[model samples]
Target: MPLHPRPRALPTAFVAVLALLLAAGNGTWATTGAGAQDRAGSAPRPAALAGRVIVTVAGQQDAGRAAARAEVRARRVYRFALNGFAATLTEKQAARLANDPEVVGIFPDRTVSVAAQTLPKGVDRVDADRHPGAAIDGVDRGVDADIAILDTGIAPAHADLNVVGGKACVTGDATTRDIHTHGTHVAGSAAARDNGIGVVGVAPGARLYAVKVLSDSGGGTISDVVCGLDWVTANAATIDVANLSLAGGGPDGACGQPTTDPFHQAVCNTVAAGVPVVVAAGNTPGAGRDIASSNIVPATYAEAITVSAFTDFNGRPGGGGAAICAASGAVDDVFAPYSNFGADVDIAAPGTCTYSTLPNGGYGYKSGTSMAAGYVSGAVALYRAQNPGASPDAVRAWLLGTAQPQRSGFGFTGDKDAFAEPVLSLGDGSFPSPTPTTTATATASASATSTATAIRTATTNTATATRTPTATRTPTATARRTATKTPTRTPTRTPTRTPTRSLTATPTRTPTANTTATATATATATAFVSTPPPTATVVTATATATATATTGTTAAPYRVAASGRSANSNSSLYLYDRKPATVWISNPATTPPTVAFAYLDLGSAKPIGAVRWLVGADGTADSFRVQVSNDRATWINLTANPLANGPTGTWHELRITTTARYVRFYVTNPNADPRIGGFAEVEIWP
Candidate 1:
């Protein structure tokens, strides 16, 4: 693993001899592959450049070229500028030529292969959705950034992915379209478009370029990989990020010196050009432990932002669906079973059953650290796009600093240092303006108005309006029921007993016979059960309790946003209007769509007790799940089963126990009429 000395210069005598041989036309080497040979009369075939081995020579560029040409018909690929030239030569010829003083080493072109590998959750988990300018003019705007994927090419026409352009290092023609799905999938994970038909990527707006080092069979060699890296380096200024999902060979200490490992050297040069690299922490299927020391190439390379996989078994914590593996407790953000981990891993992302784009116009699922690295690549693109002048070090710092701390029990069994790998948590790009105080103030006013309305109704209806403070305060079970059916009148009845206590008196003074009993009944009933306006006194008390469920809690109104919504009347804004009567309905087109998700960004992390929902007067989803996320990506499910009890015109409150900056309500399945979904309002409890 020790560093090797730099390549040495060739002898002047050897160079002269090689020049003489080339001048005498004594070096005639045939090319390899289909249609590689020149016509009988055509100028003697130029050295085959395709599929040629990159020969590292101990000489100056001109001398190395002269020596290679003298020994065999060689078409230079790298031009020996980096002390190496890819040339066409048979195994026997290469072996014979190695004895020359100018030729230092002859390595068989090793075939590198594509490493086979999502989504709003992964995007939100990394907080890419929170990136500044994510949405502009009513549409989600992608960052103006570019990333290169060095794999099995890409399908630029894939509907969900946007590939700018790329080069192929494979045999024959130079087309970068994906022959294998690996590169396509990796590309999708990193920058699939935000178009509604397929999955959205972590940075859906970034331009993607493919460096096809791997062939259709998912195999290529070290030389091919270096070729791809060289291309990436050549255009580093245009590519802010690069992701290498493929990994080969075991680690042999630190990234070896350039003289010993051209791959490392190429990657080093690429990073030096200001483009950050992300690579997969290679997988170890049955071992269930760290493989960092296995000498994984790009991953172990010091410049890479190595990423490991975490199995978001249920997509969100506490939620359930098909799992990548059997995992229990705190499974949402657990480390993936097959992921490699160790000191080298820089971070982790959801890689289990990640959904993304595929080649030939389709989409599919794959799981691996390859997918995880793509997510990081996308994250880096977002960061670079937002901070165009940021250096590689600054980008890495921001990425690492904002990562969410990992829990030890979350399925990770790697070294303690590996377990500490931070789960990526891209913070909201900017602090949201604090919600207006008028929002809460309005809720208080509504409570008071409802109470007054109820009392006035009582005054016009029953003589009990004049009952004693104690008598009016103690409502019998039957009376409470009637009060609920007419909530407006209920509060009036309570204060009737304390008219002497003043109509503006606190409602709690007239304690119900059993607060627990009242809560038990109302808690189970849909919020839609028509109730008289709550007396300002009692409503204030209940609201306070709901808001203060967590100690030192601060309740702020949230900004509502939906993946799909109807016209302006039912827009997402209505969800936060503090009026249970005002509703926000989804567009009919989104009913059974792939992702039926709506969210509220609270601007800042807050502890929430319950989420209140008013199912639309039109219809409600048969079942839906609520999830929470600090970064808006790695959502934690707050419920065990999707709630399906709401009927049209009913109000339901799901009691959740978690703290997050964003909360999402996802419809798991459509109703009888899938396209007919609606919601009157969604409220976060204080």
Candidate 2:
């Protein structure tokens, strides 16, 4: 079976427990291995290693040793090794040995994704600055505190991060250098130095220890995670905070017990050693289920301090207005649409569209509860620095006790209890005082130079609307590079007065052939596409009135109320005029590889029943959403996940029931074909 999208990865039990869980992390798209075998055949490519499995042996270290010997006797080849008496094996071999008396259990080694960055707003929102630093008194800023980031890894050379040292528990390497941007973003949010070039962190002075568990592909196995936990446990005396911006399966039960669940015990032991473990509550929406009952690990564990996510309405800390999701109320703080909430969530922080550092000294935006957890980890580091003698339980108590409770309710059910309690401020009167520095705006430019730790002299204007920055990739830990090669303009569609028809829709123009040379260099580094084709000119043709509408009858024509294209292009009005020949295209040059979206505002109120799209060029769109809204303020999702489209120029219609003045077509996930996204015609039925 293939793995479905979930927050972080799936859950895994110890050697005694047999079930294997495979869930994806925040904002990652995973595909099951269904391709052909390779030529050499010694080992399958990591991305397509479907037959690879991790087997756990019961008992103690002695039992693991016995299991290894038994596997050899059975003619099974074991690759990786873990402290929990586990080893990686072939699927067939694992099944054959599962019934062995010495073998505890066998399961698949599932992949997880990297799931970061308006991190300071979240920190300030939690009130972490009051206790110490230049603004207050004493030495706050996590001067002596250490946080162990268990993720893809940290860029050891990033000027913004004070990375003291780390280990690659999964790769068996000593250097914990990050190639993926996920871990770097988390590290920046938790502790990007006070250096002025990039964004600041809650504990800018904290020492970061990268415990690489997940691979650069953003996935890993229970064995790898177990290795990381064991390493942290051995060094718990020096590490004060452990940030787990990853997640997996729900717990079978509570965390107090160690017999049934090894994961629970692993995290529990770390906490018992006085190191506070902060985890993401997850981005999976609980829908109707009480989130408290959900089984997400680490977050659900009683010993771990779980953090949820909120949208800062104005996209700034303490700033208020409209939220990322229309369903969220108009306020400074509101629950993020993707955030998981319930009794398990101890605190909420800004997680939507947070801009932070990328792996190779670059910076961009990311969103998820994983991003929210980073803020809490920084706060924990600050608290630990201020009170070196405070126990984990005492620190957790003060952190939760001093939080500012939310007053506004979440959407639909108006559930306030699920996430009403959050950390709005953090500060204690225990530290010393000193110099004052002016706060700088947290923003990144298109071509930023990787500079040393220093404050920025120029300030960037804060953005309030939901905007995705260009895609970025960190090729190596020692160098810096931008994913986008050419300068691309922002796509725009502003609605005019008349409702009968919308203004012309514009598709991004093809970049010059020269642009391809620069783009080709980035393909190897970014995870957005595995094997990209050679430079091929992507052409989007104007759709003519050839195809007939299949879904809805013509209603008053609606123009684009608001639209955001990932790249700049010329405008074409034929998109909404019932024409089938004209098209709207997205620019593939957008950094951070973002999806395009449009909000159509009906000129007047009307009964909307269906929406149809004629997809061209690329036959499929990986993921998208159709949502309706009244007054362009509150919106409702009509479908979940992306709809599978047909071949080029085929019209796909979605039926819905809603009377609204606004409709939005948002591409939440990027298409497999990065160069082109085409829509020949859009039809709305009454």
Candidate 3:
């Protein structure tokens, strides 16, 4: 079976754990892979199809020993020599080929993704200074980009939250505020506006749409996480990205993770839709490898942009590396005392003294992988803000391509996490154009096949709303990538590797409160499909990056109020909670991604049983919807050619389910010639 979308890429944050947990710093992030696949709909390219045929001295370090020693000596395209294997491939690439028994598995040349983290300084209440770097730099401007935080809910009115729209999957509260401020904290870090008095955010100008999956008390079910993603899919209009600051389960090493988990699939779906998601590494070191097991859920979801936490020092005296800190045992992922370490980790960030948003009129400090995720989310916004023409995958590639290489332990081995600090750098939005060696190496070995991963076809209604992903691969210390020598392969145990490192510098001040000024929306008319697309052309321009947000809340003036009613099909703005309507003005380019939200009246609001539609008025069979009442039992809902009905109406196709929780099956199947469609939330009360 092809790997489903559910499998999450290792959290970039895990890399931080490696940076923190281990001594000998100087490790960097790795290069990101391509292809935006949805766990539920798309599948990892067939190992047979996506893989290539390449002979190598994999999993046999002994032949390996001669070959390994020889390869290293020749340096003719060589990498680190792990214990059991010595093939050439990235951690992700190596994991992709782990099943080939006869050939042996490859390993990443120090590939990284995520890291362990520290509690942030918490959202502080300070005033912003506009002079020079006094303002938020490298932050995502306030362009209405949907950001999802899979942690505790946000305090809807936190001065620092700058939250314009949100939905709680665990609490089922789409209206008012949430009790917990986890989401607010994460959201604030990724995109709090830089109003003069408040702390600036990474992407201050971006319009943040919060999707609350976890509960007020903190943790939540896998089902709620999945629903939260689904809700984001339905309302892409207001969201361009998502932040997942939580995880479940412990390490399941080696095979990476399975692609069949529902929560994994839901997150993959968002990525496939061209939206980027950021997830956290687990706070606890995984089950096995000291700090190996990664938190499940979004962290393991293949498409999420995972992050790791980093501190200011390099766990050693007078020995701080660039981005590596001293006394790291206390803070930071690179030297983070408690971060989970392994191939799944992607990148590291300043997690301590971090400031964003919090629950009440109150804000306090707490450390964990969550704070690290926020830092990455902020950087992702800047990447998008700088390159609107970049595809989600391409954007991912750019982030990875620019990461400074990080090393592990005493050896400079493996690839870096997919992303690292100084987060965004511009890149031509393009896929890896056929690398003969690298491409072919990924091909499946002609070995006996076993279960790739299970895909349960549960009753659409019977499946859990969100299912935590599981990894069948038994946790293996071998997968952790510590710089160990062959023969004994004992993990390099050095005095510097002590877990009890101290914090050299004190934590930074708390973050400032939110105070986004209200500004009018400005729409621009540019072509998105044009070759070398316009330079970050603004559809709703005012919402630029995090810094500008505090200056003013300028975005498309549109919203769906509490009492608004919709019949069969109606595309609404995912971020718009107001009563106005704003049609995006970007010219057609590659399939234009969009999202919107609406209320399902069922029978209460007299929406008299209607089906919903979003594709071109008459373009059915191209883009379609799969309907589900309970959100679990899903069936296809096709759009009949207008054939003379309301511009966009429901009920013309499939029917007889429930009246509430209706959502259209929206997609941009094609990539060329930008496709246009609107998302509509409707109810069919027959």
Candidate 4:
């Protein structure tokens, strides 16, 4: 007899009556006859089909009833990330449950396996070796952040690891101990203690939580993976970062939606709860050639930081080094041949011949995107330790913004897709200062006492000739005049001159001046001039002019608040970050040929006259539309007709006239081989 025998068939009339009753109880069926017709249209299968299925409940209140209606006992119930249960159900039962109003989705359980294919030098290559206490000196200085390794169980007794705690989700595994070596290798690559004897991880001594989702053989089901995420989400406050050195089957476009893709939903909830997830771009088996990273789960989700593998033979930037234990044709300092690529890949890291810890307190080398992701998790731990409450998006921004571009000396020879993603670098001096501080001095020589007022006026006029700087000064002059009688008297004598100077400045400064600087200068000047003496008035005026000059020094010609004011679907944050190497790729699975979009929020409604964007290597958009909106509900087309296709890796601009806070890009047809969409950077002009 089968483990799960098919249930006996029921009479059509009886099944129909049962369905109507269940629908009414769930408040999905109205007393009207039309409701009954709708229920009958979605009838269950005639015969039972045996299999395990995951049923995602629309709400916690519906779980019990939904399972009862299906007459199946749940094997596992998820709470934190997903409100659902895993159960064995016949095809007929699954179809009935899927029709339930409270059921979000029902997915067949699929096998998930470890993405093992690592390193001592991956740390040095990514520059993690430069961090304090990250060296292999046999001493544990201790790491401040906690990382969850969602793979096979970790080696609890390994001296080189600091496995603080863990939860086992796999069956027959009551303890969070590694019987297989994959999870142990991953843990060591991410946070192996900095001990002199063996090997040091990317972030030495980081607290490791072994959330074993895969069995000892390094294989499990989607339900098991979701269980691990549920555990992580429950303990999100304690886990700063999580790494999944594992992969399931093909991509799910509906991963962002609540109804489809349980793993994707779990990752989204985990990240939303403050724990950043880093996942592997699964290695392509057999062929040993690259494929789109979007072809894999978790990596296909935009919420997680998806990483691909690269080879760095000498553990340093710049090419010319020979490949060590890499696949044939794998070049040094380039993307690995067996690694996944394409637009979904956020970044790359040293993956070939990585040295790290294994099970039984052993040490060895492995190579694949799994190792690459582990290195990134370690980097994230290091970053989070310094930035205690940084959001997942902020961490992603930092990682991308600081990554080293793979161009010129950086090596892009083996990059199949040519997305040119930046490689991860954690050295202290690798990235630009987060809050770049620039000091600019503008000296305005007002003849201490100009005997001839006309000469002083003429000097101010000459300064105004430098349009950009003078534009910002006009407001400073008016602010000073309005705040004090002394400056007012001086300006009144040369009213025409003051007006001329202000007019000259308005054109250049009004559109691009930093509002914060102007406001700060105005407030400071007002406070100082409140009780001004003749000498104090002159000093304050000079200082105000200098402040005005400094205000424009850092302001870009046409600036948009691209920092934290944009949202996208099926895309990454790299689109507006102004980094050419960091490109945003649309999930081909999620993006339909007719419509795919990404938008920028200008913070508030403003005059937008033109848009400039750079395309990625995938291909150009065959037909694209630009729309603007104030509330993001009602949209007005900026382009009267769709823009024609253009070349890739080059800037394209669209001229338009509109006022809106939100500027949206709609790709009607992405003219690429895979029907994907992408953008390297976008700039809005006023």
Off by over 4 Å in 1: 1-53, 57-67, 73-76, 79-83, 88-104, 117-120, 136-140, 250-256, 317-332, 408-419, 429-686
So what's the TM-score on candidate 4? 0.61
- Give the winner by lDDT: 3 or 4: 4
The sequence of per-residue lDDT tens digits that candidate 4 reaches over residues 85-147 is: 888887677657655676666666667777761236677777676655354455667667778
| Cα lDDT, model 4, residue 346 | 75
Tens digit per residue, CA lDDT, model 2, 292-386: 55556655666677777776544344444554343322245556666666666666677766666788677877777777778777777665665
lDDT, candidate 2, at 469: 38
Report the candidate with higher TM-score, 3 versus 4. Answer: 4
Give the RMSD in angstroms, all C-alphas superposed, for model 4: 18.6
Ranking by TM-score: 4, 1, 2, 3
For all predicted structures, in order, the TM-scores are 0.52, 0.49, 0.40, 0.61
lDDT of each: 0.51, 0.49, 0.35, 0.57
Q: Write the per-residue lDDT of candidate 3 for residues 107-193, one digit (tens) a residue.
A: 121211222212222212111122121234434234333355545555666665566666655534553355655566666666666
Candidate 4 runs further than 4 Å off: 1-49, 62-65, 117-119, 132-138, 285-294, 322-328, 430-563, 566-576, 579-686
Instruction: Give the clash total for candidate 2.
Output: 38
- Positional deviation of 5 in candidate 2, in angstroms? 39
